[model samples]
Target: MNIIDKALNIFAPGIAAKREQARTEVVRQQAVRKVTNSLIGGVGSNGRGYGKHGASTTKSSMLFWKTPVGDADTDIHQNVPKLRERARDLHMGSDIVAAAHKGLRTNIVGTGLRLNPAFDASYLGLTKEHAETLRSSIQREWALWADTTKCDAAGLNDFYELQGLAFISTLMSGDVFALMPSKPRPWSVYDLKVNLIEADRCATPPDKVNIDRERIQSGVEVDADGMVVAYHFSNRHPGAGGYSLSGSNEWVRVNKYGKRTGRVNVLHLFEAERPGQRRGIPVIAPIIESLKQLSQYTNAELAAAVITSMYTVFITTPADDEGGTPFDGVGMDDEDLDGAEDVPGATGDEIKLGQGAIMRTDPGEDVKFADPTRPNPNYEAFVRAMLKQIAAALELPYEILTKQFTSSYSASRGALLEAWKMYRMRRAWLSKTFCQPIYEEWFVEAVSKGRIDAPGIFDDPAIFAAYTKAEWHGPSQGLLDPTKEVQAAVMRMDNNLSTGTRETAEINGGSWEDNVQQRAYEQTRLKKLGLVQAAPTVVTPSEPSNEGDEDNDDEEGGEQN
Candidate 1:
């Protein structure tokens, strides 16, 4: 005991000093943590903010949902299929969703996104005349390829119709894929064709190859840098009707681009918002819940109105007296009950009504007409409010989305202007993601086949870009008030803020060149017919006519005599 006690006594002073220092360090860390947490934002208990009710644990409004951080690919991979199915179901059922998709198709891809070849003349070292000639040649050839069934893989829809279908399909299924496979048909000169498939077909293969440098997210295979390298597709739709699941198992892996040509092979079309989002969320995702509720509310109101209109009366009989209804003057008959159809609701009873019939219950019996205070007074208001929110989420105005322009001209015009802004943005996106890429791939083949005059395109990337410089023209934004809108367009042109080419193209979806040429032809024809059009004469009220009026002179002479 004495020997051990000596060692403990010797190290006691050092041990005490170390313990105090450790305690002081712990206190310092706690103090620093408190300062940093306060400076940044103290622990937010349930919501967006650390202040006020956001951190209140006991408040009913504070749900205290604890969500851990997750990547977009992980999230999208789990929910996209269900979301796609729900979105498709809603599109078929919900009037609002159907209308949105309808308007989207019309606005974004009306007629079609026609290719307007705008050759970069400056970059190509060509004069305006030369560039325009080349553009015309390429456009004519493009029309030959895009306007026929030859452009489609299935030999059905033309490129123009495919635009609308593809756009709607993307919005429906969150994403869509297009495989540009070449097939030489005896009827067609161009071998390029477009084939579209739903997003379901594009999915991760069963045996996942997760290497250090490459991995597959859902169906998209990406490199270490997150650049899409390839896409995996199933031969048949994953949801095709099959008793055995084996039919949906086989997958085809397609590279994103042809290795030799560096031309686009598979086009994966989607609208990814987040940085790491491997797939798209459906366009109707944000409004899904609201739209579903609104659809149900609308249906409920409609049914209630119909039932209210259908005349039904409840006849209660006394226990002592079981007799005929007063009006019919006949006892409740088996045939009448059997013949009567069930009421159009969950009443599980037979009821009928005549055009101008009166019901008189027996003295002992009581009668109560079914009075469902329906056609709810707040139905329109509630629907409109919900639609406004839905429209906001869809980046459209309530008036534009619903096509109810009961508002003033200014308000209607303002809504159209705002809506057109979104439409234009969407049109641009479609042009880039869907239309332009297809055009480029088609153009590549056209160049190789000597159908298009794109010299030096194969040699230089910059040259290819210059030759492929183009503009996509969709349907015009219809004018609400033609007079005012036309005048505005005129003013814009006069001020040099816009050009005649642009004004004609935007306002009427017509080419300025074509309009001018047609007008000139008409004028020349009029001259030949000796019916030359004259300039309209204008006279000021202050100025007198060149010839004096004979009636005025005669009246003056008579008055003088």
Candidate 2:
């Protein structure tokens, strides 16, 4: 070997290694530069450019900025109609939605209308003898007006059912309107009828008369003080047939009917979500996306189950037996195109494909079946979580919403108690907004017509307030453990923590005075029938004896022995 050839070969390997290292270094430097540029340029790690002012660059993030911002009512005014329509559709289409409404109605108003007269009899200048007479008189007059036969045009059972319907309407629509109009009756002391108006009937007045001063928007006219002065109602409901965009659909301006003392006659029932929100958003608005997703998930699960049940059977035949029937001796028929016919060896009855009928194949043919597994294991857990979120958004307990109580007793009771708090608050709001106004108007009419004997009814504001004071009773939330609850109530009363009046009012939603009167009447009837209920007697405990007294007693016993 030549020495020069050997040296050249050894150096060639080293030169190749150096070139490879240099190339790698260049690539590494380029990568570092690119990463540095991205970091300094406010770009996301994913290579998407940053939004303006370093916001997220994704389309979803940018879409949030497009949301409108303004006063609550103004922002939602145009969308209210659409929201109501969607909410109604959801309520009708979804079982859970319907169940929710039904449960709320049952809890809020059960059985019938029960408003107890709690008027201050002494303040009205009536003696005890006259007080009972006056209360009964007022109650009878209220019954006359509140009876379904006299009050509602649509023939609901009574005012109680009307209240329930109003609640449902308010939930479906953003709000509901009730118009109190007087009618004439020969035998009645006062003729007051309640007309329920759909939200569609009230709209921005078409005439637009003095819009600058009236500030009329969405059928409601508000004054400088932000109080509703009048309501512009379409002659017919906007949703009614024959509605047109022409000037033919005239708006009737009904001056806000109320007393001179700032009590409104037109009752609008809705729960406001914001400080300046003039109109309500549907209860379902906040959870609509979740509801849609849940519905889709449910439908997908059902579809999967159906697909899994569909078993496909395949029959293989010999290469040369294309014209032969799979069933051995059965011949092909022109009439049985879909292959629904009795086979030769089978019973004479027709065999349907999906009705668990046995299939007969040729001796050498192979039968293969396809069965699909469906309904993912995570489906139920995922659905349950989604329903919980929906219940939260609706201000209801999950158990209450789904009507499934697999929870512990304590947990279930806690949920029920918490739900009752919200229910009570809503009930109070409904009564204040809807029931009280109607009662006040009725009171004024009854006093004017001399049906109720309240002296100085018009002169003094204090008299008006005292005479109009009433307590509305709804269905009782019966105790889960009646014995324990009754004992606790008795203890509370004995300890002066609560009064009989309050306890009576809480238990059955009845007035204490009314209950006492009813009990007295029962006792009178029992006396007439010579049947007496034994009164319960309380025995006081004796004090413990001292040790000396016991010894003395022992000695006396020994002496006697």
Candidate 3:
């Protein structure tokens, strides 16, 4: 026998045994963690809650705040239509519009399912070819539920027609998402399969079970106080029985068919319009109506998923970089530095917080001392208010209990604003710092080419593109845009239009005459629109009010009687 063959035979059992032992250890650890952390009984962060009779401080464990039955208090829910109108006025598309135009986006939600170890061996017992077929079946089932598309109005209408089939498919898909149950371990991954529903698959039941019903219009029944009601009706007991209205103001109606049978529920929101109500006005109507339909099955309940809107406004101030300073290394005479001893040296904070600073120097002074140490506390307060409003609307208080979740979400928001600010500031800084060098190089070339007299350097897109696209000699080429200057200029024009005047000449190209004409046209238009200093034409009253008139008083008394 060969030496190698003998060695392999001798050590094979030892290696296999070690591998099996390691696998067993992993399984044990997982079991321990899941058991301990579970809400029932154990230890660590898990053992609290109903089964264990111990409550957890974690946000995930807290019962969601009950949303008020009817309209949200404090006008917290967004006026979606108005917001969209405003966006349109700003020449920007709304999210719904964008979604309708583009396709829906898919993303990873929670963790994916894990294999059940108890059934692992049996699952593996199937032939390899059969196992492949089973895996394909799972994939097909997931695709039916996980995939979504945002089509135009016509397509959405088609989906509504197929609502029943969609609903059944959604529930069946959720059952496919089973994962191995963990008792206790270091890490536990939670996965969720979300089901979507159409907005209008409901009908009112035969009897009113303490739920107030109001006839808002002919053939249209709504709850009292003008709330639109939609319900899923099931003949079974859990879905139809044991459901009762909590109070007059309560809007949630749970239709229980029977114990452990099914749950049929309806979420109510104020109707968009009714008789004695103005048409096309969004009167506290539910915006995300589809979410209500999703709650028909499972333990899911409704909560106002509040979203606060905000804009990252930039406040420009003077630059504070040492390189940009007059006497840093710009060849300022030594006497200037000596004379400026009264001024404070710029710190890192000042340099970074360079925007929105007040120039504390003299009006005639060239070297502006922008106090970079202080940031706009007002802006910070505005951001905090926006966050608080979002939380409050969601019926949640900003507390330490949900610190981890709050911090993570809040950090994301702050990070987005910070990134937006940094991007704009960086662009501005680059423009300010690099302009002269770029201009100088172009100017030199233009002069040499007999094209400098009319300042053609800024106007010639071809020349700018050439310089931008040029690269060091190598086998491969750089991917820089050759038309950088032209593109940047166009972007600046777009930015100006978004935040300022629509007069293109003021921001882009204009002669003195053109500027004058543009200003005159704008002023005339504003005056015509009653936005300028122009008095609105007074008209005679359509009808005079009968104040303290006996005739009007008699008519009112007759109607009352």
Superior by TM-score: candidate 1 or candidate 3:
1
> Which digits, one per residue and each the tens of the lDDT, describe model 1 over residues 372-447?
7777888887787888889999999888788876555555667788988988998999899889999888888888
Off by over 4 Å in 3: 1-124, 137-206, 209-380, 388-561
Give the Cα-based TM-score of candidate 3 against the true structure.
0.19
Off by over 4 Å in 1: 1-41, 45-49, 53-59, 209-214, 243-248, 319-331, 334-339, 343-363, 536-561
lDDT of 3 by residue, 265-296 (tens): 22121222324331122211232232122222
Among these predictions, the greatest lDDT belongs to: 1
* TM-scores, all models, native as reference: 0.82, 0.74, 0.19
* Sort by lDDT, top down from the best: 1, 2, 3
lDDT tens per residue, model 2, 1-561: 366546645878675666668878999998997888677774544444554434554556564665446776567766788888888888888777788777877887665536777788777777887888878888888887786456664445467778888888888887998888888756645677677888878887645744663367677788888877888788777677888745568777777754565656578888877765566778888777778777777887896686456454666766655664444335534343254433337654333344243466666778878666665878877887888888898789888888775554455567788889888887887788777788888888888888878888788888888888887767766776555566777878888999776677667766777688898999999899999867955433334323233334444322211
lDDT of each: 0.78, 0.72, 0.31
